[model samples]
Target: QLTGISLSGDQKQKPADLEKELDKLQTEFDEIENQIRAGSPRYAALTGAQPLTLAETQQKVLDDGTVLLEYSLGNDTSYAFAVTQSGVSLFKLPPRSNIDKLATDFRAQLIPPKLQRRIVGIDVVAEQQRGLGLVEGPSENLTAFVASSNALYRAAVEPASNSFGDKRLLVVADGALNYIPFEALVRSTDGADYASLSYLIKSNEIVYAPSASVVAAIRQSGNKPSGKNLLAVADPIFSSDDSRVKGKAGVPAPAEARGLGLGLESAVNDVAGEPTAAGGLRLARLVGTRVEAEEIGKIAKSNGSQADLWIDLNASEDNLRSRDVTNYRIIHVATHGLLDAERPQFTGVVLSLVGNKDNDGFLRTDEIFNLRLGAPLVMLSACETGLGKEKRGEGVIGLTRAFMYAGAPTVGVSLWSVADKSTADLMADFYRRLLGPASSNSASVAMRAAQLGLISGKKYSAPFYWAPFVIVGDWR
Candidate 1:
């Protein structure tokens, strides 16, 4: 869509106005996502045939700051190396063309061999022995980590890009991490347009924080030890907060919907000055965060129906498992969600704390299904709950689906990392219009009102306003 316009240095044309300037900026990112996705199919053409081969690879960060990857490139072939999606590769890969024609098998190893490691995640099922599947390293490289931490996050986002043709905010986790990459985690929130990115870091909120049960499942797969790369958030950013976002929180907060709308406009609607390209639009307005119950009440108030709103702020790893959610009319969790093509169960939500004490913890989707949710709706306001291992009977198996299967009629879930500041606004306004005194509106009507609240910028409206909340299923 980008025709590579030539700017006139002679009499430089500034944007006609503010909207024009923003449109220019928005189109730039729009083109980037489009270009990458458009280029995916061509990768297969750059293939070289190889005989039976089982490839071994390693990823390393050199002293000079260059990420070095060493891999076996049979006798005669010109191959370029690319880092895999995970920041945990201990090996290198040949040029995408050379390996495109060969079949491969990928198995993870425990205890990284080197300190400066590259590549954190990979999918083994898509192995193509004869150019059937494209190599994983033919995409984006993430150099998103603090220099102080001495950890560099390198990823080949091509696989995920190819898997789901739709544009998404792909989050790849490092096995079991002692510290979540808080810095890298925050950068992508303004996928498109979000209000005051700084405000989000300050608020530290999210639609869903993973449940302990789901986090445990992700851990059992390959995300244990607080060092391995196991979490990845790949979801979409819908720039509107539908007030009737069917979740717990009985006494909906009293706030207008302007904040979230503004957030979405800044995150998704603004273009910084680029022309709208042909085809669909894609921006990175997702908000991603990690909050535990101890920090924000995990267990709902009262074990019965009235308990969904105020979860026990004291709910920690010790209480996540024994908790039963069958009585509520709606369920809302601020947790994590993962999609593992190799292991769906390994794909789960991360709880706020890790330890057994009232320290927040992870939860699995399996447990979400087990809940006797008498509630008609649920909200897994966490990252990637809508995404899951692409399988047949399994369908979409993250927390959202788990609750749906467990008998919840409808649910509201996010497709990517959401902006915290926007999330607070989305939640507050959604509840205000849906369950608050203005309970006489339909889902769509409530959503429009939320959008209006964002654009209007009333007391509660913010740029991160409308883009974080999404309506899932039929919220009639």
Candidate 2:
């Protein structure tokens, strides 16, 4: 079976060779499936619901003033399918290699290089200096990023511009393109400063989906009404030396550890252990998240909704699993997110490590699949929560998919390591817009508004701060 194919590429093959091999394997699998169907009439029943065809998807999933841009990265030449209610238009895109390089360069500019550290065997400095370049005015990083963004727009979106009038976009990106935030792409470089540049977000609301079939399924299973409004978990205490910990242990504090109440843009630290090791990992404290969560809870309450806030010791894996978290309309977790590319199952959101025998701090992807989340939205306000191992046709097999399977209609995730205070500020504005009076009450709309607000502000006007967060799945 194709499942046996090592996605890790232990023996790397050229793109052309890989495509040929996949095609050959798929043909054999199809013949075997045909034989099975001929042998037993019950084969169809065993296969569950088949994927929706283009016509079915157009009728059932898409609406007027909405366009679905789906891309398939190929060996020789990539293709983009612009699916609207009117018709499906095909556009030629750059080859996989070209798109991959552009996407990598674009992401690098948005997320600065990580600082090398020997103690935790992790990169720390980059997180501390995330949005420094854009703040200092038209640095090399900003210029390079704008160039890359515009190039990507030409390669990915501009070709299909005619098919996409003034409409909401449902993007299905493949391979490396999955990491590129579509909303951040510049329409055309007008020599405007970073803050005033014409971003795609300014014109259209965008939402991402793994596939058309997934979109149909999510829309079919509409959001269930929840008793509580918001359940926010944040500010997990990682070190025993933390002042919040009553009995201070003698373990050394994390390197370059700063004061707890430092401002938002202060250096945020990550706790790392040997890739194979578990337990005794010391994550730097996220003091800004405490304020972030509290402010969100207050907003929910003022908007006439019940809000539950969990912080410090209370924000543990035990509490996450034990509590009736499914009862809330929105579940916001603000903490560290660890991405395990080699082992996607290990990709998890870090909560308070202080727990009982079975509880470790990590809420790994496999564990998230077991969660019963009925919330309309689940926001993982942490570093690289949107990233995961890429499976050929399965989109990103990471935290987003796990939550979707667990019953969240929509999810908000970060593409890169986000600034602490800027993220908090963005989330506060997002929640206010989401729950406020005269609100559209749509996740996609609120996200766009929040990002626009950040761009207009002086503090976090850079794409690094506002562009990382994207809404996936049901826009409403």
The digit string of per-residue lDDT tens for model 2 on 201-298 reads 98889999877777677666665535447989998766555678766454233211322211111112222322211222245677778999999999
lDDT of 2 at 379: 93
| Candidate that scores best on lDDT | 2
Model 1 per-residue lDDT tens digits across residues 49-122:
11111121111111111122222333444222322333223333334333422211000111112211211111
Of candidate 1, the 10-residue stretch with the lowest lDDT total is: 103-112
Among these predictions, the greatest TM-score belongs to 2
Candidate 1, residue 29: Cα displacement in angstroms equals 40
The C-alpha RMSD in Å for every predicted model, in order, reads 24.5, 9.2
- What TM-score should be assigned to candidate 1? 0.35
Q: Enumerate residue pairs that collide in model 2.
A: 115-126
lDDT over C-alpha atoms for residue 276 of model 2: 15
Alpha-carbon deviation at 184 in model 1, angstroms: 24
